[model samples]
Target chain A: MKHTLPILIRKEVTQFRRNKVLPRIVVMMPLMLVLVLPLVTQMDVKNISVAFIDHDRSPLTLRMESHLAHSNYFRLCEPVGSFEEAEQMLDDGKVDLVVSIPEHFERHLTLGDPKPILLEANAVNATKGAQGMQYALQTIASAAMEKARGRGAAIGAEQLLTVENRYNPTGNYRHFMLPALMIVLLILVCCFLPLLNIMTEKEHGTIEQINVTPVGRLEFILAKLIPYWLLALVLLAVAMLLAWAVYGLLPAGAAALVFLAAFLFALCISGFAVTIANISDTMQQAIFVMFFFVMFFMLMSGLFTPIDSMPRWAQGITYAFPPRYVIDVFRSVYLKGTLFAELWFDFLMLTLLAVVFNLLATVTYKKQS
Target chain B: MDNIITVSNLTKQFGSFTAVDHITFAVSRGEIFGFLGANGAGKTTAMRMLCGLSKPTSGSGSVAGYDLRTQGEQIKRHIGYMSQRFSLYEDLTVAENMELYGGIYGLSRREVSDRVDQLLTALQFADHRDDLVGSLPLGWKQKLAFMVATVHRPELVFLDEPTGGVDPITRRQFWDLIRAAAAQGTTIFVTTHYMDEAEYCHRISIMVDGQIRALDTPAVLRARYGADTMEQVFYRLAREAKRGD
Candidate 1:
């Protein structure tokens, strides 16, 4: 009786547990995202089909074909007789690349004047096309170098640059996506769940009854937000567990730092959602408004891509997104092993957004109009 | 009996339209006040202002001894309100709904639990306490809503179209509960479209086109309008209106 917040929180939690779909979704969504999405959303391109037009038909050409065949990057088609046939294969989508070795390819290599081989690629799928072509060029260059070295050409191993990838040494896309996917989980749990919860009460006419009660607006809003914030944190823990169990990916930095970032982001997003709920009277209005903003936040917040690579204007807009700050915290903490000192700016931005959104929620929520 | 509600010249305007135009009335302790009106006749609007759910555009009033304009939160604590729409959470069980409203009104857990038990037992639906309110029939939900509204034992309670669609038998049962509340000195301010129900009120006020055209006991109102029934008395006044619906 002293405080209604605890009772209100209990009601929300009970309703959430009793919901038919929400409980199931809360459990299954993160599991699916952690277990399944990593394998599919990978940026590492593989499984390219190359049709070889071996006009030279020399041992070097055969060796090149064999080398391409042996490599995991390219799958060889039956050697076509002409470029037209190989191009036809490319057009039919049967092959991604067409390699036409010239007639004097091996002879030119012996003369130390290697002829340029024609590499035709279907550029419709740009990343696959660009990466496939690059892999083919490297393979052919190395094969040509081996032949050149056999002829005593002065191409020493020291001439090639040795490159080393730091942090994520193997560049596993799953390791990168694990943290980003956790952020997506937060958006769904903290943002959308609280929004839908409030909208449901409005639609059902329950909020009207609550308005007539002696409860303070701040108390009511806190009641609405507390359950979702707790839920999002629990889901984050589950996601982290799944990431560790399935992908063997754990946060490279303090796990507590990752949780602290999640807590602030949950506060920001759930408050933002409740603010929108306060403004909107209907579920349709709330959903569309939230959808428009959440789409912008998720899409442009560098969750799937790097903000540094985006246009300057779009990158500037990303700074306003709360998700952008949290994503930075999560990625740096997970991949770069960044500490709280280095990530204080992102943490500060998230705290600022949380304060702003929660203040908006409280001020906009009118118990009596 | 002391006057429990004292509202004078309470007016609410929405843009160019006047929803509640200078309505004034008072209700004594333990009196059953019926606020009857046609569709869009502003009964709900006036009730909202009295319940502190909406602010009057202009006027001075007091509900349950609290200033309607300035002391809304205090007014809320001393009064109960049931909206026309079914407002009890459908996902919550019957006992849960009761406990929630009771807690919101600052009732202790033991007090809420005891009252819930008493109410459920009196209604002979103690077994249904664990059942969701959605699973209950409409009439039962309305009855439960009324019970939940008065769970805190406020000095005054407002019911907006409490019985819109229900069987006659159930409607009578609802009125019986109302009578019991008034017998214990709770002032009842209820709005309804049913003219027959108006006869049960200690006094009735009929509003048409944002103005109260009649306010008196049903027997006195009928005699004043030279009509035999309360329905005839209502038609005589309502027929003069230009606004419909």
Candidate 2:
């Protein structure tokens, strides 16, 4: 079995080299994600177009408009003369928000019964709309507070909360996304490569030749997986290099611990891929099965959204996914410099997944059939 | 002569359909045994049982003195199989294919290198050793596949329509290689749809609808059916077959 494994791996490597497109794609995918996706997803809504219509035209109203313009989030467009003109600008998509001051704005403030200013927002994209409204409100509230203090009136004490973001002081999104993207790339190469490799053998009829030989089923599966496993590790290293060069991010924990977790995670995914390949009779069937599982795994893995925010049942399903554990390990290792002792439970689960998946794959693969 | 393969009342059923029904056959050592049948006539199914690839539904068989039931791994080790698909890794080179199969059969590294060298030289494939098998013509690929299958020097080899898509000249050359292997005392069990190729076997069996309808020497079968050729003998039996699929 030892001798056969090297030969089988060599054959796979040769075939992999012969296919000119795959190697390039494997390298390029991670590099593109590292370079491009971070820049795209780092977008914090800024330069939102705002139109102002001041009915009172009072000094306080002018002060509020100036504050809204000076704040980084809003970009003051041409001031409109009437509410109709502001509404027309919004309808034309010229501004994302419209701020209007009512006629009694100064009078109400003088009487100590300040009326609220109307801030209309385009709610087509709900998240953007909500964030824009919050920022606008903060600017208007501060402007009102400054006006009250200038009038020599006793102002109420406001509670101030100072938030210190640990681990990431600057709140760089790449620090969070790069590690997760690395895990995603690892999953793609480790799972899909072996799945397609085995399916190709079946399609080209070489699987029947191997089946008729005295080669053990487990040996054959191992031989097929080891090459992709090694390739995924190599790709991981390249991705790390790209991360450092492009984003200046590196794992804060022991590199060995991160790699150990990656290795186990890769093995588990590869075993799952092999089992899928064993059960599927054709390439299309195998691809469909892989697609279904990978989609589910990625969705429930907390890659894009927080697992805690998901519904209770959906959160329960995330426990069954191997990527969820691996993603946690990656984030912990990369950002927090988490020790192995702190991540022992995740490590144990990954190791267990590896063994169970490989055992199932070996038992289900039938040489005689 | 010692029997290399022996079977009695071997049967295989897929649910209600009997693919190979209560068949019995034997082949002596160093003999060229030809298995002939129409499409879906159960020739391949029966050969799969004898090669230890599939278990018989209810019967007994032995190949190379190993039990077909319990010792399938041993049977596999002692025999080589070349399927109708010409099962060679197309992306691998000719020499690499030989090395892989040689290693699979548990040959030592030195043994694999030496045997691969000798086989490449003998087959005149030395010039194309490093070229991908996919780049080779169909005939050369078939020949290379045959060589790879027998690289470990097994005692018996099963070839399933090895010359299916080759030209007549290449087919003739393939037969010469088979004859040489048989001359070296390696038993050859082959299946073919070409009647002329069936005539080259020392003994042939024509299957019809999962049963062996004729099994004898070519001359004896021709005389018994009063047919001019093995093709007519096959038609005579196949015409009366009741099974459609």
Candidate 3:
């Protein structure tokens, strides 16, 4: 076969540009999400007005008060001299978490007894409350251990199980999210767009016209994938520039590594997208199906959350997700500054996905009889 | 000439829907064979199977001397197919569409340029080469779509309703192109609901309710059915086929 993939890719690019919506989405999507969105939106959760109910007034309870006061996760709002002050603060949407240390908290804890700490959190914002509870637990455990160590019990087994968060210092939500968002956006414009293109041809009768020629299935497939792949890379580069310009954060690893990982991952994305195109009979159906795919991918790929935080079956589902692999490479490069050698497993999964998708598309693409 | 298209008990189904029932036919090389049917009468389904787009649920067939089931890829390489829509990417130029089809078929850059020049010259559309197809009129697009379909000069070309929307003038011009393609030794397998178009074919098969109720030339079908014209012949056969069903 004397097929020239570049010619086909150029033709697809020409077609894509002529399609007004696709070009606009590819160019403007990241800019809207990354820069303009961030300027409009905020991650700052500071100066939260919190209610305090100090029953003990002990030195130890005072220490806990200082921890919440100094922490970015909370602020002291009201002290419930009566039950109504704290209740009013909560009802007015002021305090998010209510901590109740029983009257004998310090006395029991200091006298070799484990103390019960009662805390209530807003159910509407349960995740935030969960994070707050986590922080509170760590803070109390460390403080009690420090006091115990001063009492010369620093060698306690409970003190040894300290939680360490070394990789994502400061736990910036944007840092955690930006890399995963890049993968999701790539899938949307990359896989979803081109697959829609292929399927639309079938629906509109264009593929039948094209098939009458000597066009090889492989060449046709390359034609379908290459243009969108390059467009996706351009989208990637734009997002990369935006990530740095907006967040003041360049990916900490090699540029070549990032590009190659993204390129290979795109094959999987486009390949699966073609199968979706084959299965769907209309552009609306294809787009609707793509929404389901993107939603499931984002949810399962640990884009906005941690995979380890999910149930085991959900974690297992991530193995089937192309974004999971893309996210793996993304975090390794952006967060860990990891080299390609360190991400061989992720690379391998993406390569496998590429092969699997290609195989499925090839199997699905039919011409005449 | 020996038949370039041959079928034996060709069958196709989707779930419980039987589109193409067991049908047998052979089409001679270089002959324009018309597939006539009312809407959803299995003509497109059978045409797709012959072109290698949809597999037969059972039975067997061969096109361009290649067994369809085992050598479909080879068969696809040798045959051209114009779908019912006769659709082309309006966003692409005439030359762009030609080059795209050429490249898709694995033609080299030089080959594409040469074929494009020849096609543009033959179609008398060299000046508007760079203009996108969307700018072209419906008649021009239909003709251009026909030209693109036959650009590879495959051994056989399947035209499925290639003249649906165009005016009678344009439709005649389309048949002239089809005739020219056939004259160049390309066997034409075409489908149409138009009785006049059916009369132009060397032989035609009339499909009704998933069965070929009549398979003969326009003259033969008219004579065999004792009707005045192919139109009357088709109506009678359709009535007969529906009664049989």
Candidate 4:
């Protein structure tokens, strides 16, 4: 086993170097994900572009107009004369929210029960458009309150200024995206390498070479595991270092602990990949299987959205994904300076995952059965 | 010669279809035994069970004195196999590929170095030791795949259509390596459709549809079938099987 270790690692690295796409898909991709992807990817939902039509021509409607102009969450893009004009602006993608102060606006307000201001919100984009409409209503309501009650009975300004975003205090997108990307890329590289490695053997029929050698089933599996495991660890190290050097996102936890967790995470992911490789007879089938899991894991891993924002069932489903725990451990350490004790459960789940996947691969593997 | 391989009613099935039906055979030490069949004729299936890559459904064999059923680990420790494709790692230098196989077989680092040195010197390509195996010609790659397969010095070696793509000259060179290994006391269990290749084997078994149709030396198979060449004998047997089907 000691003799085979370096030999396998060297062989894997040599093979990885020869294959043009493998290393890029593994290491470079994750680095790019962390650096390039999140900088431009938007997360904030503020300052929605909307248009208004105040046909009432009254003092109350004018006050409402002034209120919208001052609101931070909205930018009133070029108001129009009629509701149809606002609709045309929305169709042309100029405005996301269309607000109409009704013709009976003053009459309704004097009765002390105003008819609702017509708000047509485009719900196509889901988040930004809806928030834009909500902000418009809130600003208009505050204006109405000022008109109904004269000056001097104002509520005191209460300071509500406590905010600390967990993983990104500096609000750095690279710091947030890169840490999660390290996990994604390591998995992409390590996971798919083993899958293709084994399937290529089977396709070329070198599996028979391992079968006849003095290497046992356990030995063969472990030998293949070495190259990929080391490659994944190296990629993980490089990714973290890149994050640190480029974005100034230092690992809050010990570097050694982060490495150990990441190392174990590779084994879990590689085991699952090799199991797929063992069963898939062709490279095409192997890649299809890998793509399915890669998409499923990355899209639902709670890297972009808070788990709280997900439906309860979706949040529950992500628990079964190994990347979920892997990402949590990474963010906990990278963003919060969290120690191992604070992140013991995530680490434990990852370790358990590694064990389960390894055993499952071993058990499912047999010579000819 | 002592029996190096023993099989008794060894069978394997995928669901209901038995790939290798109950059949018994043995090969003596240093003998070149042939496993012949058409495509999907259960030749590879039988070889896989004996090699301990797959489990037998309801039979047993002993490979290098280790029970195939109960001691696959013990079996693996004493066998070598080569497939028909370019099996050597194309990315690594020839010596590195040798080191990997030798290490996996429990060779000491020093032993791998020694064995690789011996092989490179004997093959008389000492300068090509560090060249990537992929850049080499097909003939060299085949020889290297064969050499690496036997680097651990296992008791038995199974060659599954090991020369399917190579030209006749390269195939002849590959046979010389097989013969040299046999001279070194390694039992060879090989399967090939090439009649000329079968003529060189010590004994040949012609399998059709999961059963051995003929088991004899190349000369005897021709004599019994009244055919001047092994190809004629094979053609006659295949025709008979097809007509029977």
Candidate 5:
């Protein structure tokens, strides 16, 4: 038992290296995620088209139009002569938003009875529409405030509420996305490698040879898992380096803590993969089962969205996903410098998942029938 | 001679269908025992039970003096099995496959290397020691599989249709390896569809419908059935049996 595992691991690693395409894919996937995914998902919804119909044509309205045009978030189209033309553009999908300044807009402001500024947003893509509308609102509000302050009217500070975005002061999206991408890459490699490796052996009839031997069941599974586990760690290291070099992001907490989390997470996923392989009789069955579980785990892992924001039942399902804890630990440690003491729940969850998955894999893998 | 394998009323069933109905047999030490059956005739199923790969549905058996019911692990450690698929890791080199099986059988590193070198040289596979088993021709692969199965020097080795799809020349060469192993006092339990190969066995059992219809030496079976060839003997028994092929 002592020496059998090493031999088996060596055999697996040798076979892994011998495969012409799989090793390259395993390494290239993480590199692509670290280098390319962050850039792709870093989109901030810029250059939104806006059409203006200013009836007043006053200096105040003109100033508002210029301010909206100069802002990076909105692309101001040529000033339309009438509201009808602005509405036409909106309906044609040429513009995402329309701002209309009513007649006598500046006169009402001088009398302290300001007329409402009507804004129409094309909400075809709801999130983008909402974001474009918010940008337009901020631009107009700040322009109005500048005009009021220029006239020497006292603007009350009572309604102002100061906001602070701690930890990620700049709200760098890369910092959030890179860690999530790392988790995703790790889960994919760690899970599929062992699943496919074992299934391939079964397909090739090599498993029957191993089954007839005296190799312990746990030893056989561990031997099959350790190669991919170590490969996943290597992938993690490469991804971390690429993240720092390409995105300039690093974990703010102890590097060892990040490694610990990644190792535990890899163990949990690989164990789950082995269990899948054990139950499946063919490569197709294993791949389909793996695909189903991986998709479910990724969606419920809160990698793309927050767990708390999901529906109550959906959030309850998130607790069953092992990657959810890893993602939480990754974000906390990377951005907030959270220590182990504060992250005991995540560590405990990951540890429990690892134990359960590995035990199940070992128990489910039958050497004799 | 001491019996290396003793099976009594061994049976296996899947739901209502019996695959290996209560059949009994014994194999003497260093003897070449041939287990013959048609497709789905329960030869492989019976071999699996004897190899400890599957449990008997009823009755009792022992392999290498280990109880089939409780000492399956011990039984496995003491026996070698080669299935019809030629179960060698194709992705691994010839020497690597040898080392892997040796290591699994709990051999020391030095012992594994020494045995691998000796076997490769003796089998004229020294030049291809580092070549992947997949790159080798089918005949060489089968021969290498046979060698790897007996690398641990087990007291008994089970070969389940080891020559299923090989040429007659290759099959003849394979039987040479089996005979050579038997000469060294390693009991060889083989199954073959080729009647000529069955002729090479010291004793052969023809099974029909999950029951052993004939268990005797080839000469004895031929004389009893009054047939000129083992194929005639097999056909005579199979036709007389009250079962559809």
Candidate 6:
């Protein structure tokens, strides 16, 4: 049994090298997921278009328009003569938001009787609509405050509130998603690939030849797992390097902590994958079954969305998912510089899951029936 | 002659269906034992039982001096199995497949390399040792599977329909390999659809409806049944079977 493991793992490596698609995917997935996908998948909305209707043609309203145009959040369209024209642009999807300054809007304001500025937003996409409207309101309010200050009138409410974002100072969405993307790479390489390898053996009838030998079940399962485990780590390292090189993102904590969590995650996920493969008789069945679980693992494990934002029952479901814990460890260590002392519970859960799922893999595989 | 395999009242059932009913047999060491039957006659099941690939429903048996019920792992170490389906890894090179199986049986790297060399030369394809098994012809694949099965030099090897789809010339060549293995003191327990192949066996057992209908040398069975050929002798018994598949 001791001698059999290396031979099996070597055989797996040879087969992986010969396989045309798997090796290419290993090379391509990290490059695409790390170097390219982060730039595309940012959840923070930007590039909103605004059309301004200046009725008073006052200096204050023109300053407000310039302020909105200069802000990173909004772009200005050609000036419209009336509210109807601005609304037409919104209806045609030409602009995302419309701001109308009423007639004599600056005369009333200088007399200390302010007229409300009307802002209409195209709410077809709720996020763009709501966020674009909020940004326009803030820009216009600041412009009005500047006008009042020029006349020596004091603004009192500005000092009432201050906001500071934690961990990520700029609230960059890519920083939050980079660690989750590494977990995605781990799942595809460790869990998905090994399950497909085993299922392919079953489909081709090659496993029957191995089962007839005196090789122990643990030895065979470990042999299948070890190569992928090492490959997943290498892929993780490549992804981390790419994250730093392309996005200038690196773990704030000890890099070893991230690797340790990933190591445990690889064992846990691959063992779970093998158990699924043992129960499925064909590649199709195994793939569909694995797809179902992986979809849940990626979507519900806080890779794309926050677990804390999920409903009580939905968050409860994530506790059973091993990826959820490791993803937490990845995000905390990468963004917050969380130490192992603060992450002991996550490590314990990963270890427990690794032990349980691998035991299932060894027990469920039958040499004789 | 010492028996390498012995079984009494050995049976296997899948639910209410008895795949291999109560039967008894034994094969002495180095003998080329033929298990002949029509489709689903339980030949494969019986061979699987003796090879320790499946548990018997109820029986007492031993293979390679290991108890079938208690020492399955020990039995596995002393024997090799080639299933009806082609089971060699198709993506691997010829030498790699041989080395892998040899290594699984605990052969040292030196021993596996030596065996791979011997096999590549003996099979007369030393030049193609690095060729992928998938690229080889089907007949060659079957032969390579048989060679890899015995790479560890097991005392006994079970071949279940090893020549199912090959042409007669290839089948004859496959049988020659079997005869050579037996000559080297490796017991061969095999199943074949062709009765002419049965003539090459030292002794053949005819199975029908999960029971051994006749067991003897081909000549003796033909003579006893008053038939000119083993096919006639097989038909005379098998025509009485209630199941055809």
TM-score of each: 0.93, 0.91, 0.83, 0.84, 0.95, 0.92
RMSD of each: 2.7, 3.0, 4.3, 4.4, 2.1, 2.7
Clashing pairs for model 1 are none
Model 1 chain B, TM? 0.98
The list of candidate 4 runs beyond 4 A from truth reads A24-27, A45-47, A53-75, A79-88, A91-93, A99-120, A134-178, A226-261, A332-342, B37-40, B219-227, B242-245
How does candidate 3 score on lDDT?
0.79
Per model, state how many residue pairs clash.
0, 0, 13, 7, 0, 0
lDDT of 6 by residue, A215-270 (tens): 88888888888999999999999999999998799999999999999999999999
> Can you tell me the CAPRI class of model 5?
high
The CA lDDT at A369 in model 1 is 75
State the lDDT at B76 in candidate 5.
91
Off by over 4 Å in 1: A53-64, A81-85, A100-118, A141-165
lDDT per residue (tens digit) for residues A1-369 in model 5: 688888888888898899999988986898789878888997467889999889888888888998998998899998789888899999999999999999999899778677888999999888788878877887887777788779898766532223456988866778888888999888888898889888988998889899999998888888888877788888888888888888678889987788899999998999899999999999998999999999988878888778888899998888878999999888898899999999999999999999999888988988888
lDDT of 3 by residue, B1-245 (tens): 69998899998988998888898999999999999887878998898888777878998989999997878778877887777775888888899888877776677778889999998898788999999898998889878878877777788888889888889998998899999988998999999878899889999998887777778888988888888888898788666554233
lDDT by residue for model 3 (A178-201), tens: 777677668877777787778778
True contacts kept of each: 0.90, 0.81, 0.78, 0.81, 0.91, 0.91
Q: Is the docking of candidate 1 incorrect, acceptable, medium or high quality?
A: medium
In Å, residue A278's CA in model 2 sits off its true spot by: 1.4
Arrange candidates by DockQ, descending. 5, 6, 1, 2, 4, 3
State the lDDT of candidate 1 residue by residue for A239-332, as single tens digits.
9998998878888999999999999999999989999999998999999999999899888998998889899999998878998999999989
Model 6, B149-212: lDDT tens per residue?
8999999999999999998899989998999999999999999988898899999999999999
List the candidate 6 regions with Cα displacement exceeding 4 Å: A53-62, A78-89, A99-120, A137-163
Every model: iRMSD: 1.1, 1.1, 2.6, 2.2, 0.8, 1.0
Q: Which candidate, 1 or 2, would have the higher lDDT against the true structure? A: 1
Complex DockQ per candidate? 0.77, 0.77, 0.50, 0.62, 0.87, 0.82
